[model samples]
Target: MLRLRLVTWDVKDTLLRLREPVGLSYAAEARSHGVQLQPEALSRAFRAAYAAQSRRFPNYGRAEGLSSRQWWLEVAMETFRLSGVREDAVLALMAENLYRDYCNAHSWELLPGASETLSCCRRRGLRMGVVSNFDNRLESILLRCGLRHHFHFVLTSEAAGVAKPDPEIFRTALRLGGALPEQAAHVGDDYSRDYRAAREAGMHSFLLHGHGRSAGPEVPPGHVLPTLSHLLALIEKG
Candidate 1:
């Protein structure tokens, strides 16, 4: 069996995900503020805005000393501006509300089998923790989702000062767990960010490809899994 002392997880799209399309959420919130926005346009604008913000101020601008709130507000303003809404006051208020709204269970849902898998791991006496490329609000989000108690710690990109695809974040997690690289494994949905990067950090890695999700041919079959439930089986068999 693979000797696993700790199992670290990526948060979004792995353990949990947004309840609805982000654009739909944004549109509904905007409507509440008396601004009409097409969900589709808002979606596209959001994607573009998010990408631009990430490139300009990666890891929520930790290196530049920008708080997560400040960075997200910038993204929200840019998204609204791109969607043809230019009122600064309206954008500010909507962004604030949107940011607050997202830091709770209402905006997110746990993936199928997530809770059961975590519970199983806990019963097996495995140390569990979160290693996510998320903001500092991750703890709050997990708490509201009733998942906080399952983890020994939650390390976010904002807190770590590094993002996935960079091995340092994984190293930070290993340090937190007080385990060697080979004694830990990481699970996440992204091929590059979760699998390859974690392996490069000298840890075991599993790329989660749930039902109907694709694990590109480039991925080795041994490292690809269908869900968190499969992960426990694989760990046992390893």
Candidate 2:
């Protein structure tokens, strides 16, 4: 029998895949303000700014931090500057609309075998939860994706006041789910944020290798599974 008490999952890039082109909505909004930007250009600028802001946020147990929405707001503003879009109001509106859409958007595809694996975990009597580095709107997004019911606890960085790579985020999930660290497992696509933090917190860690080759000196030593099904098999075997 499996010894796990809880199974926690990361949100983006692990369970759900974005279906629509990211910048298409931004491009449409830009056009409304008489600005013309290639979608690819906008996407690149947005990604760069987003990553920079995330890095600026306090790592681990710092008191000061930006919520995912606040961080993305800065990214959107900076991206507007990078794209030479001069309208502040337009940028703000786009940011608000895009975030709202993201919460309610079904423009995503759940990964193959994800539902089956989750169901199997549930049937095995393992309580499931989510510990994600995201804004307050993460619950709404999960609900829209029909995943809200699957998780007993959903902790976001905004709600927890600590982001991943910090043991506190994982601890919070354990506390909320009434599971000890040793009785849990965390699976995510991020090596540093998920694998390293989960293991440090005394939980088993699994790196879900999705898209992109593994790149980084800080990648953790853990089971690297290509698909959610593989993880399910490991859990079952344990």
TM-score for every candidate vs. truth? Answer: 0.97, 0.87
Residue-by-residue lDDT tens digits, candidate 1, 1-238: 9999999999999999999998999999889988889999999999999999999998999999899999999998899999988788998999998999999788999999999999999999999899999998999999999999999999998999889999999999999998999999999999889988999999998999875778999777877887778888889878
The worst-scoring run of ten residues by lDDT in candidate 1 lies at 219-228
For model 2, which pairs clash?
none
Misplaced by over 4 Å in model 1 are none
Instruction: Provide the clashing-pair count of each candidate structure.
Output: 0, 0
Report how far residue 192 has shifted in candidate 1, in Å. 0.7
Expressed as tens digits, the lDDT of each residue in 101-165 for candidate 2 is 67775667798878888888888788999988777777888888888888998888777877888
As a TM-score, model 2 comes out at 0.87
Q: What is the lDDT of candidate 1?
A: 0.92
Q: Candidate 2 — number of clashing residue pairs?
A: 0
How far residue 125's Cα lies from its native spot in candidate 2, in Å, is 1.1
